[model samples]
Target: MLQKMSSVQPFQFEPEHEISEDENIEDVQYQINQNEDDRKVYEVRVGQNGWCLCGYCLPMLTGKESVCCKELQFFAVAVPDIPCITAHTSFEAVCLNRDVLWAALVSLHDRESADLSYRYASYRQFTWWMHVIRIRNIYSEPDGIYAGFEDVDIDYTEIDQAWRDW
Candidate 1:
């Protein structure tokens, strides 16, 4: 599994933080280009964990990462809670719920990368260790409608037993 995980290094970064406090980054397009890998639509880490999309909340997908697997980068998207989360997932939520996904870019893993560091894609972009995120608004699941980040159940613990099974 370790060998398989290292295979895809899909990510890229910007010289500095691309998301500016003034740019009004309300939404983020997870995939703007073409190809098979661009179709991945990632889900947010709900439950007791909140809207986290990295670390234990994130589960490594099986097979080649043709989409939103760890291969994609998470080096720029910044949340007040998580250090550097994925802007794509975060932005998607923002588009769905105004109080979601819209975060600012803090920094980048590489110094010579582009400004859109928060963008997700298959490349040399910086990936993240903290792959967790909390929801910013009310959410409805098969179980029920959660009020907000504070209201979610966050089913996973430090190591999501369910994610591990996947």
Candidate 2:
């Protein structure tokens, strides 16, 4: 069994200016309106993967504009705290500011392949690989991901034997 707590408590007063009931009502209404407006504004949350719709594009998507740009950037520049490495890809290296992460991601997605003529598949493959590498690097740690690859040992005899067995 539990005892019921009393709802009433003794009030202590100190010297203070009194606010009128109407003034209090207005203040409360103002706070409520402000909160409502805040709710209407959309905010970007870090770590959530999605399109980086600019203010103008967002409004247009909602039928505010008859037509909107079909293309949008995907790669956001890496932030200082969130370090990136790009050695594996053709992109030598790229560092991002905290504000540019989203923009960078968008840019990567929107970037067009340079080999549009398709003279050689290798060219397209290389370009695509580089793009992917850049994206991967953006998510990698600052120290880098391939730090231990150089230390790996490879034996041609072992490889030949494994292939013969197969």
Candidate 1: minimum summed lDDT over ten consecutive residues — where?
Answer: 1-10
The lDDT of each candidate is 0.32, 0.36
lDDT tens digits by residue: candidate 1, 12-37: 23222345465543332322233234
TM-score of 1: 0.16
lDDT of 2 at 111: 22
Q: Candidate 1 at 144: error in angstroms?
A: 47
Cα RMSD for candidates in order? 22.2, 27.2
Per-residue lDDT of candidate 2, residues 57-125 (tens digit): 232233213221222111122212222222213122223344345434443342245553343344446
TM-score of each prediction: 0.16, 0.15
lDDT of 2 at 83: 21
